[model samples]
Target: MNAISPVAHPAPSDEIDLIALVQSLWRQRLLIGLVTLLTGVLAAAYAFIVTPEYQVQSVLRPALIKDLDGLNRTGVYKLTPAQAMQRVGAALDSYERRLEFFRANQGLFEALREPGRSLEQTFESFNRDAFKMLQPDPKKTDNLSAFVGIQLTYPADINGVALVNGLVEFALASERERIAADLATLVKNRLHHLDLQIAAARASYDASKEAKIAALLEADSLKRAKLQDELKALRQQLRTRRDNRVAQLDEAIRIAKSLGIGKPTTPSALGEGERASQGSVIRTEVNNQQIPLYFMGSEALEAERNALLQRRSDDFTEPRIAEIAKELQLLAQNRQVEVLNKRENEDLFLKDLATWREEAARLRNLQFEVAGLKLVSVDQVAVDPLKPIKPKRALILALGLVLGGMLGVFIALLRNMARRIPKTANSAY
Candidate 1:
């Protein structure tokens, strides 16, 4: 009896259970089919009702001024290709900034909306459907690549392509104006700085000239004073010698009279004769006797007086003074020449500054004209896309069908588990 035992019946295998699960699902096929059909119908309805989005793309190349050789040579400041490219980059950034501004100020996009729509509502709707994409081309070996790809997406109703083009044009125009204004301002500032430098240089030169002239005048004044003092001393000495000679002649005449050699001569007459001699002793007859007392004085005194006269004449005609005067005259002439030269240089500089200013103005006008004509070179303009890029109906329908079938299977499994649970509980009791 022990052996006859439940001759080892193996428990049902996992494969059998899996087969059973398939059978259970087949039994609920109607419910699964209904749910899957409903889901597919709902997906189809959504696909048809939702609006489709269209994309427009354009390719653009920055209009860079490549040949700046002439401009560089003409202007005091030079603009380089790299700098131009930098401006292009800035313009691109400005384009983005303008887009942000458009977002903040919704009224700007009102014209692009449907009739009867408020500006705020239109902006919200447009923002929901519209977007812009800017992609720069990868750098090349030449490093001068300037192509960019732009794309705009919007609902089929609006003119997104034209709007994007207009915005780009506006951005380019603004950028050109900004660059021109900046360049003009820089040129004017440089000219102003040059003017300041010239004024300072002229002022310094004038100060130096005045200082030199003052020094020269002081030296001349000192020399002239010294010579004048010397002349006065010579005149005083000559007067003293003449007086002494007159006194000696008077004394000699008195002595002769006292010795009874001759009649006495009047001192007044002798003094008057001495004065008439003009710096020399004069002989006179006194009571019919010739005194012969005419003193010529030493040759040295005469020579000294003559030398003094010569020196006085030399004071006015001294070679050193003449040389100094000539030097002063030459210095004055040189100063005048220098002043003239400085003025001439200043005038030339002012003329150059004016020319540069005119050039800057002309360049600014040219830039404005160019911007007005064409902002950027479009390699390919955006075209109206024929096909929509959203709401993939086939994929959605397939996913919905699959998901519905899965949900039906889950519900059937849950009900089967609930029934088994009650049965197991009853068995346990």
Candidate 2:
């Protein structure tokens, strides 16, 4: 209890005093108002001073030649009308062609460049600002209908309409030329291949014909030799039989003389009686001997000769040989037919190649006549736009007013908190 006489209590430092805070802010209301007004003025000035951007746009429809009616009558190109239209549409929508066009006219963007800006930077800026878009038209129903639409956007200050039209023309022409050249080259190559094939086919046909002829000749020679050998063997057998018959008859006469049958006594006795008696006795001996004799009759000999001749003829005109000959004939006919077909095909290809050449020449001439190419028709050409597209002054000023009011309130609260903290520190000391 030594110094417990009177203890002084310190105020709570962490408690929020709402009434005091309100009073402090009220005192600094003038400063807050001044800062808010100044911020609003600055925002308004910025909105008015900044340069606004403007845009010019145009709508285009692909003006491609459909059905190739002009060229179709000549039968030069094989593409159908639908195919032709598709090709044109594809060329129009090609990004590569668009890029090529952009690069080609990159120098045209130099006029839009500011001082101290590099050409590359200017080109990049121009590219970012420009736009090209393609879309299918909703109104068209046909598959081959020319209903595609193209829109191009550019800065309002430049002559963007003419530039876009020029680029479209150039791209279309280049694509056409490229397609024609490719087709012509293809036809030429095919024709050359067909020529080579025809030559090879002709050679093959000739070789086959010669081989068949040689085979037929060899077969005929073999048949003739075989027939001759058979005939010679038959002739030799006949000669041997005839010689044996003569020998047998001579033996029979010798035997009759030995037996003293019909013997002649004197030379005068060699008359009719002796001859008759000798012939009768010789006949009797021939009957008694029982010898087998071969008597070749005139008719039989003639028949054998006829049979040999017939066999010789049959050898030459064998059925197998006839069949082979028939086959060879058919083969020759087929080869001839094949060659004829090839010739016909070659003629057709030649005609097709000629047509391709004519078409290519026509396209070349057409390109020369029309200096630049045109892919599309400008539906609505871009005109000079008067209104700027950027910098909404009213919107910016409204946002600035709201933000400035909030910041002023935050500053007033911070100052009040700062003064309160010092007072609390002094009371603690």
Candidate 3:
């Protein structure tokens, strides 16, 4: 083997030299420089010619009015305006419930979906025309309500103020509307009743006066009281008469004894208390003619006593007091029956009157309750925005350019980086 030197070879991609490349670029400097100048100029021209947009921003806070317990307007027990607004907001949110709120917001959907209507119009019409934004949003909201913003864009030499003003009109034009149904309040009612009480009262009033009935009752009571009084007096008179009769009988016996008709000691009349003095308990012995003769005088006195008893029986025979007492008792029973009847009739009337009063009171209370349900306001904000917010064109263009530039550089580098490697060899002689 002859002594031969080995050779190293460079890859095709690496064969490019800095000096040659500079010479080639110098030779094409005019075209290269022109291309760069043209690119920059075109970019400047495009940027300058791009549309300029004016934006309006609206900050919307839900309208909130403070309302107290639906009864007080300005009392201590009232909810704050913010709280009421929150409640309204919640209710508004509940509008999403399709079945329940239709009664309250009737025709609202129709108004919102009106032809040629704007998104803001539909949302703004939630409370119908009762609501209006003092300051509108600058951009279109990406919500179901679709509240919109107004923006104006102008070309390089175009007037921005006019464009923005026109855009604003377009955005604000043709408002969507919904019907307002919150004016009517919720209420519960019960049926009214007053006739029953009135009827009962009238019936009672009719029963209070009756000619025969009054007379019969009065007469019966008077007869009973009079009979009772008379019985009491007769008892006292009878006692006095009995005492006088006893005395008279004793005197008569003395007179009889003087005339030799009976024993002087014999009592012609005697009360139970005076029986011992009158020999009421004495027993006479019998069996001898002489003994009969001796007590003959006592027997005559005893006969006198029997005759007095007969007279006393005749004098006191009529028990008129007993008869009167019986009649009085009958009258009293009749009076009690009448009184019970009267109570039954009067109670019916009283019940009627009570019912009437209760019904009247109930009506009055209902009226009061209705009066108490005063209309209170919830929070509603009035927008007074001085600036417009819309059209983030600058930001959009910047993002677009960055994305385009990254894509351009990545594609250029990918094309230059080849997958295969080159090989070199030296010839043998």
Candidate 4:
């Protein structure tokens, strides 16, 4: 058998050769450089030709105490500086409010519209990307005061400063109007309540007056009844006294007729003759002397009896009768009750009437000059930017150079590998 020679084997195609790759890369260095240069030029063109966007910001802080004096003095609505700042911030952040501003001033946003896009779509995009509300981060140590800001990123050609400033003013005016309207409503309600209270007071006063009048009338009636009863009792007493006197006079007349006495006779005249005969002994003791009615002659008794029988009215006999008549006449009409009934404006005498009216008047005349009232203080107004925020030329150029180098190296590696595949196939054959 002939000795077999060891055949030489070619390197495996899967194995990489570092020296060959390096040589291939050096040979294509011009192509890589060309690609990088092209990319750099393209990036520069983009940086220069593209529309630039500028950022404008308006900062707001708490309003001064004196600035909100007019609003606070009203007393109906009390607002603090922090609360006011919050309200302004809320207004600025409101989407509906933004849309309202946009519709009212359509000319300001004309530049935002693009061809083949509806105004609504353009606004949606602008609202989503351009408008931003800024607040101090709670985690930041430098945040010492409460603040709010409205930031807008807009095209350089547009008047971004004016737009931001206008938006801020619009938000402030809206909040002011809302506050004023709310205060007005509250005041109106308060006035209405006070009017109701006044009406109630008047009604109560009238009721009291009426009750007093009724009491007076009742008292007068009772007084008149009492006087009438007294007058009747007095008349009866006078009549009884007159009848008893007539009976006594009749009896005395009969006794005088029996004694055969025709004229008036006194006991003293009959005793005078006896006392003259029995004189000389003086008695110190005194006794009540009694006189008999029959001593008056029958003619005198008959005449007095006739006069008593002929009497028609016993009113003159009793002085109390006249007094009672006068009192009854006086009580017939209660002057106090009559005067109270005739009063026209009972409210004038009502309790707390003056206080209620005064309060209502004060509410009606209250002044709240919301236009001059400051809800928020502007710490920084929107100003034109010195340069565009977007289209950073240096950064773009650097990124382009890096990306172009990577792409060129990838293409060079692919071409070198493709060129080695044919050589490997020929050696195998």
Q: lDDT per prediction?
A: 0.59, 0.57, 0.42, 0.87
Model 2, C-alpha of 46: deviation from truth (Å)? 4.4
Backbone collisions counted per model:
0, 2, 17, 0
lDDT per residue (tens digit) for residues 51-76 in model 4: 99899999999988888877888777
**TM-score, cand. 4:** 0.79
Q: Choose 1 or 2, whichever is better by TM-score.
A: 1
lDDT of 3 by residue, 174-261 (tens): 1101101121121111113355546546665555535546767788778777887887778777766756665555665565555455
- lDDT tens digits by residue: candidate 1, 116-218: 8765566556555565546554555344465565567776666766756655555556666765576567666765766676666667666765786666656
Q: What root-mean-square deviation over C-alphas does model 3 reach?
A: 14.2
Question: Model 1, stretches more than 4 Å misplaced?
Answer: 1-16, 57-108, 111-150, 194-223, 233-380, 415-429
- Please give me the total number of clashing residue pairs in predicted model 1: 0
What's model 3's lDDT at 209?
39
Error of 4 at 194 (Å): 3.8
Can you give the TM-score per candidate against the true fold? 0.58, 0.50, 0.36, 0.79
Task: Report the poorest 10 consecutive residues by lDDT, candidate 1.
Answer: 293-302
**Candidate number of the best TM-score:** 4
